[model samples]
Target chain A: MPEKVEITPESAVRAVLRDILGLDAEQVAGFDADTELFGALPELDSMAVAGLLTELEDRLDIMIEDDEVDGELFETFGNLVAFAETKAEE
Target chain B: MMLRLEEHNIGAILPDLPGTNESMQPQHAMDLDKWASALLSFSEQAENPTHVASFRGGSLVDHKIELPHWRLSPVKGRSLLRTMMRTRIAADKESGLSTSMSDLMETAHRDVLNLAGNLLNPEMIKQLDSAQPFEFSDTRTVRLESEAKEADAIVNGGPFWLRAEPSDDMDLVTAISNDLIDWVNG
Candidate 1:
């Protein structure tokens, strides 16, 4: 099997935004090791919110319970990067 | 920053190139709004009602309604109507199911082909009367109103729509198709 390549949280977030919501980097403002998501992107809708959750679960090879998702966790783009970081770190 | 990529879906996907448009930032937004308003007012008679069959929001050819996150396309408009039914099935919220087509006749983006799908034969598409212009005088509006009253018969009332399966009618169908033709030509 191929070894796990080093993937940064920034790149991962960009990949998800482009592939899922049809959004690009400019549309997604800011990033961080710690930041809020649900507040950042104004265009972020419920469908996008769902798509992000699904992508994270699949890409990180982790399982996120439905209860774990909430509006607060997605207040900004940074918040999203942080959440994925937690998954990646774990 | 990769912003606008010239692509539609996984099928219409173009090469991944980050397009730079310094002038289009504000202009792009204005264009989007203009397109939306044009599509909305494309129908001269609002009382005639517009129905979208399928919605997969397209930038140039289609528009998105964010409330339900539906993208009404000119060709897949019927799928929009199909989606309504699918939603009902998904929620498992069925009871009396008494609906009229009129109630579901809200403003939605539509696929042109789906409008006259059943009526038009594939054999004579080009020969069919598609580009016929609509005259929207007050008298025309009155004609629409009369047609709607007759069409309203199939629909129970307002909530009456949720209860029944979807059926086809000539007047509503004509309005839907003609509006799309005007949009494409306009």
Candidate 2:
């Protein structure tokens, strides 16, 4: 039997962004703590955001209630990753 | 995908299921059973041995094919429905109309619903919400390495289906082609 690979919340967040926004590895890797997301990235529109949240929930195996999602959570790369990390712990 | 399959002398026929793509049927009038029957009928017309390869929501209906199935990251119908619903809600919010999941579901139950871009009826929504891939002995399930779902094989690839625009990933395509060849010939 193969060992299960552990997925970190930060990595999960990165993957969701890549998949949902169609960004390449280099582009996502370029994002730093302060890199803005929602408004800064034009591709991260409302439709994409819905898909992004679903992908994040699927990858992290965490349920995100509708109320938990706000514009602030997607304000920056750090905030999104931090939210994922918090969700993973709970 | 067709080119790769052709290299292995495997002919492929991508049919338009009822109410989808080029099909003349109305989307709002189609249900799971109708789609499944369409697949079954299509398979019957093939002269050679056929293998079903389904992706995402297609898995729910591919079970009716009665052939050895190869599924790539097959998803439950409810998950697909939820994504569409979420997309609809997000679109509505963008237009200054606040909508909830319950609101959408209620409308779907009562009348035809325009979700994301597709028009679906109540019965279609009801069936999709509870549909699951059938468990069969001849099935081989494949999932992306990022996914934690139980699968017969795991492959490395990004979820291109979720991308905002149509994009090509040859490495991912080649990997899938190779795996599918092995599955078919093995």
lDDT of 1 by residue, B54-165 (tens): 2222322223221111112111223233333233322332345533223223211221222212222222122221311122121011112211221111211111111122
lDDT of 2 by residue, B10-38 (tens): 88888888898887888889988789998
Docking category for candidate 1?
incorrect
> Chain A TM-score, candidate 1?
0.69
Clashing pairs in 2: none
Deviation from native of the Cα of residue B110 in model 2, angstroms: 1.2
Angstrom error of the Cα, residue B107, model 2: value is: 1.0
Which one wins on DockQ? 2
* RMSD (Å) per prediction: 22.7, 2.0
